[model samples]
Target: MKSGDMFEAEPGSANRQEINPLLKLALELGPLMIFFFANARGERIAAAFPFLQDLGGPLFLATAAFMVATAIALAVSWVMTRKLPIMPLVSGAVVLVFGGLTLWLQDETFIKVKPTIVNGLFAAILLGGLLFGRSLLAYVFDSAFRLTAEGWKKLTLAWGVFFVFLAILNEIIWRNFSTDFWVAFKVWGIMPITFIFTLAMVPIITRHNLGDDSPQDP
Candidate 1:
């Protein structure tokens, strides 16, 4: 199957609802924010909920909250759009699985390595698509912008490498750092780094843009 088929919404659907960019951002970030908050205030939350203390500690509590929040986010997306975006769907699946394992095993390691698995999977899919001469990244961004085939290939390669970098970074941090520090980095550090990386790609997007009135190059 094509990488786009795995990670992007189906192409050329007449009834597909377009999500507002701001709302999309909120949906994507909301679960992570909840996870961070739950971790930071685990004691207070457990005091209120009481039963959550059985889950073990802050990371475990955060994992449970993260799983619930992720489910809610995905459900809301499906209700609004009648379809789930593939990337988020994949990530959410990981969250649920790892989160469940963390809770059941009473081991924080499962949840801690979740990002590494997700990012590595994404990198593999993107790079593997290129091996088969498909620029699957185009499908993911086609709604937002248009770029030449060459541009898509370049962008895809950049993103694939970035994902690998993220996976490695996650491994390094979670393995070496305190759970609190790791959680903080996952929430604050990664998001800003991703945002900055996106901004840095502006030149590539502009250079490769298929303009509003211009046809794609043959």
Candidate 2:
């Protein structure tokens, strides 16, 4: 399975047109990283700046900065590609909307539960796509693997289920854990769990390999 076809890359700049996965991850995760570090250094920063003490706490400062950083990232991506990624666009829009509510209402719960809403929406999109005889997950994984139709169907189902699982996990984390723990898990836990889940699909991927001997490239 060639990894090239999944990306709807522009001609002549196929390499540059599509953002690299790792860099994309960084952009998506950068704000959260800033939040975690800001929370960790809030006291020091407050001591140095003095005025930051009015922001209430390190956590508050972190959330404010996260909002700014996320907005910046989306802006940069929009500028570079002139196209918004489906998942990030959805998530970023939710962030802006809910982040605005959180700031406006001065209640952090809105931001805390944003993941739950996002995951639930993704699960619905994938599951509903299947119901409509469409596998929207293809748009995401297509960039990474050129699997056969059967592989795509199976993989899409797997992703749909995985998203449901993530929603449940997020619900549990936020419900049972402290705000700090939830924030930490949001940043550190999701990527590793997703990477592991992606690796776990290797067997199905192998079964639908679509090898060099099977089909000649046009």
Compare the candidates by TM-score and give the number of the best one.
1
Candidate 1 stretches greater than 4 Å from native: 1-8, 11-16, 214-218
lDDT by residue for model 1 (114-194), tens = 999999988998899899987767656766777787888888999999999999999999999898899999989999999
Judge candidate 1 against the unseen true structure and give its global Cα lDDT, from 0 to 1: 0.84
Q: How close is candidate 2 to the true structure, as a TM-score?
A: 0.81
Candidate 2 lDDT over residue span 142-207, tens digit each: 545556767767887899899999999999998899988887887789989998999999998788
Q: lDDT winner among the candidates?
A: 1
TM-score of predicted structure 1: 0.90
User: How close to the true structure is residue 69 of candidate 1, measured as C-alpha lDDT?
Assistant: 89
The lDDT of model 2 is: 0.75
Task: Please give me the total number of clashing residue pairs in predicted model 1.
Answer: 0
Question: Given candidate 1, what's the lDDT at residue 137?
Answer: 74
Superposed by TM-score, candidate 2 places the C-alpha of residue 2 at a distance from the truth, in angstroms, of 31
Model 2 residue 118 lDDT score: 83
Model 2 off-target regions past 4 Å?
1-17, 49-55, 211-218
Candidate 1 positional error at 29, Å: 1.1
